[model samples]
Target: MTLPSAYTEAPARRFNVGERVRVKLAFPPGHRRTPVYVRGKSGVVERVCGAFANPEELAYGFDGNPKRVLYRVRFRQRELWSDYAGSESDHLELEIYEHWLEAA
Candidate 1:
């Protein structure tokens, strides 16, 4: 059974502000929280948003124990899409878990 998000806490934190990182390209079944469009994309960490229960694990009815660190990653809008029509200065930011991010 799934537990409330407030029941657990992250045990560790990783990554840092302004660090270049890439999102892992994954399509695992069930309880997914990452966006497909951002997969395999590289971006910079804008801020460390502290740890929270792992949504990926929570979706499956686990405790989501040992919460994961969440980061505010910034990516160029053009990089996320192939057909770009917006201003070049446009950007997209997302809150990504540490497990979904890696050094670029």
Candidate 2:
């Protein structure tokens, strides 16, 4: 089955590369693009990877609205895990949707 165009259009971006942002600490149920481990964590917007249908919403069979902006966010491994074994320079990158983020 073919999805509508809204599912593939470019979303109006709310962030920029190199900008700091905080992921929402939410755990609302369903298929979310943002991983649970990264919730409530702070990171830098590494790149704006364009928009796509909101997977969280689409998972329920609805045509996603106002497409979500996908961003590659970089976070320090130490920040995500207090007892991380990696070096301070070590980091993890995640592709998070705009709605899941806030200005840091």
Best by lDDT: 2
Candidate with top TM-score is 2
Would you estimate the TM-scores of all the predictions?
0.84, 0.86
The alpha-carbon lDDT assigned to residue 25 of candidate 2 equals 98
Residue 79 displacement in candidate 2 (angstroms):
0.6
lDDT of 1 at 17: 73
In model 2, state the lDDT of residue 72. Answer: 81
Overall local distance difference test of candidate 2:
0.84
* lDDT, each prediction: 0.82, 0.84
Residue 19's C-alpha lDDT in candidate 2?
92
Q: Which residue pairs overlap in candidate 2's backbone?
A: none
lDDT of 2 at 10: 44
